[model samples]
Target chain A: MRRITILGLTVLVTAAVLVAAPLLGLETIDPRQVAGGAGAGPEARIFWSLRVPRVMLGFLAGAALSVGGLTFQALFRNALATPYTLGVSSGAALGATLAIRLGAAFSLLGIPAVSLAAFAGALLAVALVYGLARARQGCSANIMLLAGVAVNFSFASLILLVHYTSDAAASFNILRWLMGRLDTVGPDEALRLLPLVAVGGFVALALHRELNLMSVDEELAVSRGVDVDRYRVILFVTTSVMVGGVVAACGPIGFVGMMVPHVCRLLIGPDHRWLGPMSLLAGGAFLVACDVLARLLAAPAELPVGVLTSLLGGPFFLWLLVGRRGAACSA
Target chain B: MDANRTLTPVLDLRHLRLELDGRSILDDVSLAVREGEHLAIVGPNGAGKTCLLKCVNRILRGWRGMISVNGVSIAAFSQRELGRLVAYVPQVGGRLTPFTARETVLMARYPHLTPFAAPGLRDQRYAEDALALTGIGALADRSLDTLSGGERQKVYLAAALAQDARLLLLDEPATFLDPRHRDDFRRVLRTVNRRKGVTVVEVTHDLNCAVLDADRIFALKDGRAAFCGPPEQFMVREVMHRVFDRAFLTVNHPTTGQPVILPEVGGP
Candidate 1:
């Protein structure tokens, strides 16, 4: 009953935020206007085409990254593990940099060329990490972690090379893209990320018990009937795919993947059954809140929501950890 | 468990060999354990005692040989099937997850459950009963990380007991337990073996434990089966010396008349 109440409250807050966020941007949009079907004006287009999609993109990206982070953390049994631990973000950044440098102007299958390249790069990084870290037994956590770090370094170097050789305009574009944005061209980007989040989130939540068992001990999990090797690969692939889509849509928005799950874990306790759903909902709402602040903090101008997430998340997470000493987090 | 089933071994290993990094851990080791029998695997350090249990539990794969449980080849069984047949407790407790004690014990019901389903009333009852049997009921709500080493180990034992498998493979399970808990554990093992008709295979360095608790003693030396016989035959000095590379001073227990093997110290 208590768990349900907690989740119910989260759902309420997330719905409220979802309803209210799209209307509170630089442009004023009435609640009834948002509720009623598309009207004919600049306001209707701004509300329907711009604000709503941007907020949806923020929510999708945040939910995907946070779930990815928690899944990785549970898989590796390390609290510090994040979505980009295996170089997915760095790989996406490199690909996006290349796309910007080459001035790729084509879209395929209703998705932009840059997003496709980003997804491809993210998959490549995961493949490389898996191949390098895999042993006869499987991918051991320590080896995989080290492999991820190495891959990150390599991708970052490549991204630096792309950034350095580009002309001034392209360099600035790369710099701004690196900061991350939730400015959607339409509902398309949000729609693109939706299925990835749904599949990844559903799989992770459905396998919550296995995640618990695996988090405790790989050997124990196997002895208790979990196919550790097979599930390990499944988990990695799912997280990578969701993270790839998110990174493709909005560049690599940092901190949501790293911080949101920790906060959710501390709030809901580490039972992934509850933690999984809570992380997804809270991640979406928290990003919406941050994006709202991003629009409001600098009136008439806006900072990238990514910058605010990383900046706000560091101090907030530090403050959370500072006094409590992870009393709630450790559970 | 039946009279006729006793004629065939419940657990059998043939030509079981394991190699790690080009060096053999277990070389052509073979043994059979009867149903409802308590078999103690006794050996010195690096004698592959733990490795043998792991092989039986199918935790350490890539071994070259046949392992059959209940007359069926282990290879034919899925991991879940194997889990329902055999339970394992490591030399020490596995890593501590964020679950409380009761939650940890409930996880042992995994093999019997479908994916995505929560543990039902029977599973919860078994978990509670296991915790009570292990004398850690008061700690049921405590997170595993907060428990002491001995307490944590008891939680793991409770988990294995709750697993309700036919065979139990324990690797020095009492290494972290207090003497009182050890006595309680021994009694629990006796009841589980005699009353429940469950097979037990324990790896222990303590020879006294073997003679006292086990129906048979299987001694290993350099990963080879040095001795496999009844406890009475295994109590002989020649068998002990061959497996352990040492001299033993054997004395009969004053109360039970069972021979106890102790190390012979020259200076003393």
Candidate 2:
């Protein structure tokens, strides 16, 4: 009954946010205008072309990141894990920064060259981290974590150097992209990330039992017949690609990856069976709600959704930790 | 005994050797257990008793040897395939994972069910049978965190049983249990061994329970196979002393009329 209630609440929140968030903005659109065909008026154009696409993109980014985050936490058996735990975000940031610094202008498949470059950077970081961890036989989750730290710091340094030498305007642009926003994202960006989220969500759902066993212990997982190493690699590579796509599309929208799964675990519990879908739904709704707040709180001058996420993530976790309502550990 | 000798061993290890960091963990160990046999492995700490079990289950690799379950090499089967043949219950010191006793047990049926497919009637029946066999059916819905150590160990046992494997490997399964729960656990294991016709191999610290329960005992000392035979041979003072490097006293239990081995408590 409790599981059903929590899952129902998640579905409700997702529905409410999907329906309500797009209708709200700097200029409110009539629901009937949106219900009318495209280009019925200016409101229709804004609704069809801008608000809906942005909310969809936000949903894609949140769902992908949260599922990825849940997978990493289970793989590493660490509650602090997030989609960015493996250096993908830093790599994407570096790629975008370098592109902005160099003024790369070759777009392919209708994708901005910057997005392509960010994706390339993300893959490079994952490859490097995976290679370093595989330097020895039987790569453990701890080894991969250390490898991620090494690559993340190195990529971060490179990004700093890129930012430090760039012109003022380009540096500001890079900084803004890093802070992440959904304001200008449209149908094209949403379409690009859809495959990634689909693939990531599929892998996570398929390995739900493995996720549950592994979170208990590696030995436990092995004894239960999980192809521990192979599955770990599969999960790692898939989530990296999905997260890379998300960061490329949304500029590493922060907190949804870390915070959503944590909060869902609190409301529901650690059974990955429910946790996987619930995390995806709650994550999407949470980010959209925050995106709405980002627009509304400052009206006419929008706060980047990334700024609000990080600003809120730390304090909310603190509250979850210190409040007497009591938070349970993943174990 | 002649008919048993003709049957293929349910578990067989041929000259297994494992070395880590320039030290031998298991040295040239070889043993075989027939189907339905209950074998106990006993040794002091670091004797590689648990390590031997780890090698069988593939949790610890880098060992040079051949291991076979039910006449097939361990290499021949995928991990999932092998899990259908051998279930391992590791020592009960694992993190209290937030699964209910039932969910944790049902995970044993994982290797059997297709991914994304709900448990069929047979799968549910197997889980229920395991729960009933281990007498944990009442605790099936209880979260692992809410379970006591003895209760949790029973949950692990139930999980292994639910795998419906032909053989079960346990590592110090009752270390956390008190005397009463330990007896209950032993009783459940005996039922699984005798009634279900499943082979059981376990590493144990309780010599008395081992002698009372196991059909045979395999003792390891300093990474070497020290002894293998019927418990009647193991209950002798000199054999026990040779393996443990300490003296022992043997006495017949007044109630059970069985030989019990006790360590020589007084100095030399």
The candidate that wins on lDDT is 2
Once superposed on the true structure, which residue ranges of model 1 sit more than 4 Å away at CA? A135-137, A317-331, B253-258
Q: TM-scores across all candidates?
A: 0.96, 0.95
DockQ of candidate 2, scored on C-alphas against the true complex (2 decimals): 0.72
The prediction achieving the highest DockQ against the true structure is: 2
Query: Candidate 2 lDDT, tens digit per residue, A1-331?
Result: 5998889988987999999998998887779877876669888888888889989998988888889999999998877676587889999999999999999888999888888989999989889887887887567778888888888899889999999999999899899989998875458889878998999889998888888888888887888888887888788889999999999878978878888888888778888888999999988888898999998899999999999999999888787667713343652
Error in Å for residue A220 of model 1: 0.5
What is the fnat of model 2 with respect to the true interface contacts? 0.71
Clashes within 3 Å, all models in order: 0, 0
Q: In candidate 2, residue A137 scores what lDDT?
A: 59
The residue-by-residue lDDT of candidate 1 on A242-290, one tens digit each, is 9998998898888898888888776677788998999998998988888
Q: List the residue pairs that clash in candidate 1.
A: none
